[model samples]
Target: MRKLLYLTGLFILYSMQSMAQANDYVQIQAGSYQLGDTASLANPKRTVYIESFWISKFELTNAEFEKFVQATSYKTLAERYHNAMVFEPGLAEFRWLQDSTAYWRFPNGVSRGGIEAKMDHPVTCISYKDVLAYCRWADCRLPSFDEWEVAARAGSEGYYFEGFSKENMSEYANVWHGRDHLKADYSDGYLYTSPVGKFKPSPWGLFDIFGNVFEFCTGKLHGDGDRYVAHARGGSWWCSKNSCSAFNTVYIGSVRPNASFSNLGFRVVKKAFTPGDKDF
Candidate 1:
């Protein structure tokens, strides 16, 4: 019994070490790829150059963010400000309201279960500033607009990635089923955020690049003065074709740095590094 337990402990430790070494990221090689579609801010489908960078395979999850909070005693903007945007269900149309108690742990407030039930789901209700703080603690940074779109598109050029069909959109992403409905369609078996990697991933093995939650990227908003907005890309579960169609890989949702929403989250990236790097 002792030997078995000891072996299990060693295996767990080894797995953790391996993940750390890999940074749990997918490397997009330096190259040119088509960027944007007609319905997007970055339109024209122009070819753009992207230097190689490492992006996390999955969105940041509650479990991972909890570790940073526990270690650094961090308080997210939602917690500090006592309010965050939440999608109130069972309405004539989508109702996004600011709820005071909706923090990362209780995404929809106390009505929904705690973070324990959502450890694997992407962490939401986090602001751009909160994301930056987490990245700093993790020794990583946010991916730029081009880098994120590159990884999201992989090698495909159309709105959705290759192998996408409207007949079975659920197989590809967690997007809304159809036209605007009071609540999210549960026909896809999830009314809210699905677990990361629950659906298909991009060709680069990056998961949940389409739907789940909008992943924020640094970008400029037109006519917005000097304040830049975080470009919320890839849409979210709340996105519907007739509504917020940013899920199509072209349109981008933008938010301020201090804004927090229930359907907005982010991933991290790091400069290309080898296993022999001192930091690694």
Candidate 2:
């Protein structure tokens, strides 16, 4: 009788644990996204399988990033290095030239006083290495390319789940909402960033995965600027219709690991697989 009771208790514990894993995760229906189309841009579609895992429902907010900085006193690459390509107002002042003083805190570095913005907007001007370091501190990591895509697409087939037309960009992303670089008013009355979760959540409950900022991903590259580094994905706020499209598939590297840009940032993903795990 004692042995039977013990066995039953163990069985119940095992069942509960199994059920938790299944219910805690959302299964991303695996598929392929064609690259280099009006929808896919100049990227080639590749086969990728991403396992189930939990991701942030929204981009890392400035308030949250501040917590990381406060705890670790971690200096972002942008701070350690200058001329980091910031977006400042006034075309004549910053016309076709990168600002050497630009960093995460001072995106364009035009403000003489300091940042007075709110803290809920997605943190930008962060490098891949900085993201990786933050993730490590939090016991989290960046999502893979396929994982990021699956979350971004949110089970949609349209050029953008919101729509493919440029006219629809403002409703979905922060791209060219108010500012127009061609005109002086381009810098007038624009919120460089908005609070995270301000936009509607994707079908999978992820927020701002497509536009607020480009996210870093985990992948080894063998060509282009990625020959010696991993690549990042998603477009950024600085993107333009003719020059930079935030919805397109793009990638960069973490080889230097110290490189930082205002347009770059990242999201976190929990590891679902471990060594010798044949469950993939």
Candidate 3:
């Protein structure tokens, strides 16, 4: 039987445990969008057609992920590996470092309050597989590359997503800038991750789509598909104009599904199925 469901006041289907505390889901209309840009080698320009789907307005929050953890007692890849990953911007290059205690609880591996303090913050230190586990528990799945970009663009067009240029990016998304790449700038008021929806949302009503954390999508880079089955969308707070600008709309990155990182996280997507399909 097909039944109607209400999520965040939007008529949706499949009201499940995942939608309990995180009821905010945005419905993106089916349409075509231009993908990629001239700035990066990883992204090639093309037009993509997308089907209508539902996605969270904001990145998945710690409180939401916590609910999944409490119910399933699931151990994330970081937990299984007994280590968590962090992005480090060195003098000339950037890298990811692992710390035994730097799981989702303590993104830096030393913070005391952890998620308890910032329940509304987007959850980090999670792997693509860990995301799959949450999707299974919630009866949802990660957005595909096309779906993610289509939704991330959210009907915006330009050199950048919604707000372009380096000066005003802080107003649109949580990114690292306002100074040089080699210098630390907290003018945005966040050293690490900020609470979701802290900045302006996209025109079509998606928050933190450009930056916050690189969201995992089920798309693979054809060049590196042998090792990576998933690609990351949006730049993270670690991104700057001169450094790691994958935050740029056209930028698509590959990450191992089994590897989790401190600056990496994911969001959920619900398919708009045929009229008679089982509800969620």
Error of 3 at 224 (Å): 2.1
lDDT of 2 by residue, 184-203 (tens): 32321344666666665556
Error of 3 at 199 (Å): 0.3
lDDT of 2 at 259: 60
- In model 3, the Cα lDDT at residue 44 comes to 71
**Model 2 misses residue 122 by how many Å?**
1.5
Off by over 4 Å in 3: 1-23, 38-41, 87-92, 111-113, 178-184, 272-280
Model 2 residue 198 CA deviation in Å: 1.6
RMSD of each predicted structure:
5.1, 6.3, 5.1
Candidate closest to the true structure, highest lDDT: 1
Tell me the whole-model lDDT of each prediction, alpha carbons only.
0.80, 0.60, 0.76
Model 1, which residues run further than 4 Å from truth?
1-20, 38-42, 92-94, 275-280
**Tens-place lDDT digits, model 1, residues 188-240:** 78777888988887777888888899998876645456866677788888876
Best-to-worst ranking by TM-score = 1, 3, 2
Listed in order, each prediction's TM-score against the native is 0.87, 0.72, 0.83
Per-residue error for 227 in candidate 1, Å, reads: 2.5
